[model samples]
Target: MDFNGIKGTYDVIFSLGKNCLVADQLSRHMLRKIGGVLDWVESPALPGVSHLLRNQFMNFMEFPNLAITGINEHAGCYIVRDAAYHIFSHHDFPLPENTPTQLLSYPELREKITRRVPRFLDTLRSSNRILFIRTEGTIHETAELLEVLNMQVAGEFNLLVINHAPVSGIVETPWPFPNVCALQIPLVPDEFHDNDYLWKTLLEGFHVRY
Candidate 1:
């Protein structure tokens, strides 16, 4: 997990959640060492663990319908408006069990995550250096995210993509921003979030004494 050293400190660490747990933990680690200077704001962009096979995240982001579709109760996930993926912990339903399906597409659905989208975009625009973490996703998924960001946010930035998925090795990309590092770390399913070696290498690269 040795990382090629780039330049200086990052402005923000934007995470595309397979779940927010990894991001939250990373923020804590940074907080203890670097204090609150680094931003790790929770936004509705990939709010929860998106099951890649069933509800493909690339499809969701690329083709945004703004339509509320059917729910997969077994996965405890529901797709809200603006393509937000929400997975309920402990299999709890957000609404009542027998709530009308049409009621799901009401104005209330749009209001919840709509405000945060612009805020996230604003954050992206303001920051010049970014450490984007795809906690558990593939290269194609990461590529889709880069495409969306390139369209919405202006200017180039130093991007480091630490993708903690079951990828074989370092994969190549066609994006112009040169400092991108797509890590080839295999995801340990049972011990999903804990990766001491990975973080140690990253923190060291950032010049953080861990």
Candidate 2:
């Protein structure tokens, strides 16, 4: 797990930023893989030991809803308003829940709420919380998305972005924003190469859209 030279506790979520349809196994499976990469860094478990804690993300569509074929003691739904989404640790927050019903693409959702993006930055300017954001894209793309979530959360926050290795196209370092930093990871770790492949496969899926 590359720390990216960061140290501290921050408010963040496990999100692809690119939401895919649930029924679509490929998409859902991809998210699980992506989340595995994130968890590998966020809270890597010891060899042969389980993690002390974990979280679940809910995906909501035009009309969000969730069905359970199993039992979960600690569960919560993700909340969305005006196409903006946020996931909580539990249902006490009463977020939107669904049972993998309709397709929910974050790229498409971001397009519909493009005009509202600037507001997220404004919210960041006024708060005091830290945000650990996960991205399956480039640094700049991740930065832009983080700004939106940063603005939506009406509290003080910092941004910790987990992302892919740097691209040759972008040359600047130290990030444009002092409040933001990123850890270079991959969309999918090479199974044969990544030593943690076995543990990674154990990761579950979280459909929280940023």
Candidate 3:
């Protein structure tokens, strides 16, 4: 099932009184604006469908005058988050024996993943679209990297730098990119640390007016 379906399922399962009510209302509102499940299902299968849906829903409910773009942005703007470690680490920790050897810290694993980074960057640069980078580990030099990559991509295309890091490491730097904007989110602990409070805070942070 899709993200909306999954969220609806959770609302039904938890039945968190007013919270559930709000979610149901928002879900129904979104469905109405987007022309029901048929329209949503027909939407292009893109990586950032959830973001697109949220943006659309916000425009419909909160800012009716806003001329929100559709799924075309998926092709026109490529948001590339750091997946070098994630893509490689998925093979280990909880997967069955059929996992690939590269995930096992086999010889030259780091080099193998590092080698692909340039190719991925090249592909993004070649595209006639804005490339938004969410630098994962290397937070300190993100602004510099964003400018450098933006130059390589299209100087005219907008470049957005989203610092998803919990800390203010690299974002403190003074490097400026014309098209870059920083979106910072506070760090929340994992389930083991403080699951309920963390999740509740996150939900509150993302609450919609609808």
Candidate 4:
């Protein structure tokens, strides 16, 4: 999965300016390349956690092969809440020290969201899903990060990791998963270009065409 959104919020906080446009275009391109589609589901746009989970779960039920990516750590907490009733629910995970209950006031809710993002990612790792995280900083070598992601995605329907910067370093850790692959590249101009490169790379690497 390709990620070209803001950290924590998963929102397209880029402005309408040229650089922002370039970034958005690059994101779209990457999505197309990965044999995936990008959709912007803002937090405010949804009624709440339950609504977001219900909508995504129903959508996935209709398209099991489809994978939803680009959710930040904060947004992912709602996923845990939504899956709470399931047998292998994420609700079993322990909350972090600073996370406030929803019963708290608005400021508390905001603080909780900020603190729980990392915890949410940890919880998400236990689930069977695929989640692509966008790293910070400039684009660079990323072989090491890709290796980590490969292990995380193997067997699990869902995976989560931090995208701290561009892919640049070589993998020093042992590779775990053979099936999953991570593709890292510099940001492009638009979705069309991004898709072209993404599909080409996948086709070459995995013989899978987008």
Q: Whose lDDT is greatest here?
A: 1
Which RMSD values do the candidates have, in order? Answer: 8.2, 14.9, 18.9, 16.1
What is residue 58's positional error in candidate 3, in angstroms?
41
* 1-210 per-residue lDDT for model 2 (tens digits): 123334343332333322211112223334322221123111211110111111111132223422222223434433332121222111212224333343233345434334333433343345354344443345555456555544345675454444445342211235666666654443345422342432243223322222
- Please give each candidate's TM-score: 0.52, 0.34, 0.31, 0.23
Candidate 1 positional error at 139, Å = 4.0
What tens-digit string does per-residue lDDT give for candidate 3 at 131-176? 2323222334444444454445432344222233465222332234
Clashes of 3: 1
TM-score of 1: 0.52
Give me the candidate number with maximum TM-score.
1
lDDT tens digits, residue span 1-210, model 4: 322211122111111111122224435434322211112222211123223233333322122222222223533322222222121112112234223333122344334435444443343344343333222211222334344444433334321222212434311122233322233344444432444544343223111122
The lDDT for every candidate, in the order shown, is 0.44, 0.33, 0.28, 0.28
Put down candidate 1 lDDT per residue, 1-210, tens digits, no spaces. Answer: 124545346665555544444455566457223222112212233323333212333333222444344554644444333344432221112445324344433344334335444555566677555555555444555556655656544555444555545654444333344545555554556433456555555545452233
The backbone clash count of each candidate, in order, is: 0, 14, 1, 23
Ranking of models by TM-score? 1, 2, 3, 4
